[model samples]
Target: MPENPTSQPVPFRGGGFNPRPRALIGLAVMVVLIAVWETGCRTGIIHPLVLPAPSEAATAFMELVDSGLLWTHLGASLSRLVIGWTAGTILGITVGFAIGLFSLARAGMVPLVAAIFPIPKIALLPLFIIWFGIGEGSKVATILFGTFFPTVVATYGGVDNVDRGLIRMGQSFGLSWVSIVRKIILPGALPAILPGFRISAAIAIVLLVAAEMIGAEFGVGAYILMAGSLMAMDQLIAGVAILSTIGLTVSWIIGRAEKALLRWRV
Candidate 1:
């Protein structure tokens, strides 16, 4: 007699993916932390000089807003970030694809990228200033340079990691080279590439701040530097908060892009 199929144990699926509860919980924890911090500051348990309360930072942020300095600083930083990051990402993607696909590019660019990537990008700021000058050119170049190597590494690595089976299958089907790359390789490599964007974006922001701190008259980094020099913890914290917010915003945008682009995976 055959055994009943129904007698076999079914595999368990994990809990359903509901993000709302987790998000709400995270928000609650942040609120609680802020409340505790505020209470501590008010009770003199935490020194204001060392760590300004969230309220104090908020007040400082508002003052910057009223003085019209916030936009000036923010606009300068945003301009540099957008231009530099965009240029780096585009060039990196192009070079990375070449390195991944062509033997000559891999031989030449791989060694160059590997060499430059290990160097601290901030240390190169003075060199860029000399090359591009002390104006916006140097600052943007710093961010671009910082962003480029990571993007190149990520893109080419992603391409290399694409399954050989898929490429062979495409070739067997008599697909053209361009068609195979467009359809099979790019889609396969996208999962890795998106994460790379996140990393490169973060690096770009750091380099942007570093570049601004060196010679920039108006930028978030410059504002933070001034605040620190004056020992104004509140304003400094506000500058930091702004940077944090920008990071979160970039992450959110990238997340949305991933969702849209990788819908095929789901």
Candidate 2:
């Protein structure tokens, strides 16, 4: 019997990782959660002291905006986040590349990184305050310290994961070491590095908030701390919402970057 061509498998298309349906489902879940939360508050099933209603949180957010306090807090947090994260990421990439490429650096740095990476960065906040002083410096240092280790681990791991066959192929084509690294290794390592950015960015934000809550007076963390002390659940929830917004914005930015930089993959 002859095989029928029409019965051949159609190559699967439009069935993998569709963002629209995923996004819609996520949005639906969020809407349902919010609706349930609001209903619970209205029905007195949830204590306002424990968790403010969404509407109350929204009102508090609006008041902060109208009072110009939002920008003040946002500006301080953004400055610390950018400076600390950038500094840490740059250093991590540099050191990670060195460690990945050179046995000497690996011998010296890998154990040190392993030693430090597992230590709770928040636990060092007091030490940072003592060293850098109770100011922007300390806050930034806390975030920087928290962000650095993960990035280092990520970068070197990325470099290590690059295919040896490709490196040999580059060398066979008479590519210089530097040229091969730039053209092949870096590009190959980028996918790993970009994901590391997301992790480091999140760590930076959390550390930033912790550091701010300690001694800073005009950051989102500080605002939350004050609200908690005063039992202002609405303002505290508003501050939390701001943090969520910041996380979402950062994730979106990283996603855009991945799309732009990793276009060659597709």
Candidate 3:
């Protein structure tokens, strides 16, 4: 005899798909790709010198770990990223606020920012090298230059979109310009500036590597360059993979911070 339709237990739908199962599937896909690449390399279908297989990269990673060289390169790269990104974000937010708050500031800075926006920062690499020398200063300056403009533009847009009524309400209370900006303008602009930083963080990291590659004694970028020059394909691939992972991780952290700080936006 068949059971009544209404008598069956309700299936769990709250999980949609189980998180563990979804994670396992993702891992399976990564494993499959790695396996395919490994097979291709072993069979000579893919040139190992040109594109090292996952296994080769894994071996190189272990070698670097054992030699204690990976940490040195990683540290140098991270330090530069921190210094450069901080400078860029601070400058961008300050200028953005000025432009958003005053018509005169907007009229002057907006045109200047717009004019420079189209210029490739890489073109200024030579200038930075000339002024700062091919050292840590130049490297950090290059990254700061690369990340600054986008952040400033995004932040200015955010501030501009803030509701004027709120500003008027604050003014009705006889709040000073500084007080209103601190209490209202910044909070309103937070949402726009958050995404800008997320993008800028990634760009800053990339610029750090690029700067290091051009002129640095130690950095992940320099490691990759040295490996590539020596035909150490596995090491080169490992260095690049590490750099990419770091960039993604930094972006994720910034996004999480943004969500936390902008919780009131909801």
Candidate 4:
């Protein structure tokens, strides 16, 4: 009897081709779009002021780099995001653990957090400006406000859902409360908590741009606004492209860090 083809085992494909082909296809698509855009601009079908070609944007970006202005603005924005997100994450973790562990803290803080979380951060941007001035302080405060609520909610849920049995196992081993939390609770809750950090990183970047638009002297947001006012469409687009790249890079790095640090988790 002839063997059935369906009964034959199919050979497994290697992982090497998985990402490479997809990346190549994406690159090809982008090249085609850029070529079309450049052709349109050169033919005067698309006004340079309205939609600058990729070449024009690239030239503007190179000029900014040569003038050393791009790095300076990027540094300012990066500093604000790092400081604000760090502060927000620390507070979120502390408050989340407190509420998850103690009924008293939950009863006291949950309502307050709920009330504030619904308010738009942009609506309070004016108040932050008034309180912190139009300096780095205001920008940082705005990013922190934008990031804090999401971080708190995600982390609190993670901690609250920690398995009680694991905690008891630690306790039975004569572990102190701190030791039990460090060994059992945090590890158990890490999968949930890590996603919150990723969310906060994205929120921090977005809010940093919004904050910088409000009279900031240096930063990506301010640069985009300045370019727009000057009718420098290429520069404006270049600034936006830079910000997008930064956000992507930060997200990828943090995800890799999470995988490495929480290797023990499910």
- Who wins the TM-score comparison? 2
Preferred candidate (lDDT higher): 1 or 4: 1
Clashing pairs in 4: none
lDDT by residue (tens digit), candidate 4, 1-266: 26664565668776674554355886799789889999999999998778998888999999999999988999999999899999988888888888888999999989988999888787789999899987888888988887888888887899888888888888888999999888888888777888888888988888888898898889999999999999999999999889888988988888898989888757
- Per-model clash counts, in order, read 0, 0, 0, 0
Better of 2 and 3 by lDDT: 2
TM-score of 4: 0.86
Candidate 2 residue lDDT tens string, 165-208: 99999999999999988999999999999999999999998998
Write the residue-wise lDDT of candidate 3 on 222-251 in tens digits: 998899889999998899889878977887
Superposing every Cα of model 3 onto the true structure, what RMSD results? 5.4
Per-residue lDDT tens digits of candidate 1, residues 60-176? 999999999999999999999999999999999899999999999999999899899999889988999999999899999988988889989999999999999999999999999
What are the candidates' C-alpha RMSDs?
4.7, 4.5, 5.4, 4.4
Quote the positional error of residue 213 for candidate 2 in Å. Answer: 0.6
Order the numbered candidates by TM-score, best leading. 2, 1, 3, 4
lDDT of the candidates, in the order given: 0.93, 0.93, 0.87, 0.87
Off by over 4 Å in 1: 1-21
**Angstrom error at residue 146, model 2:** 0.8
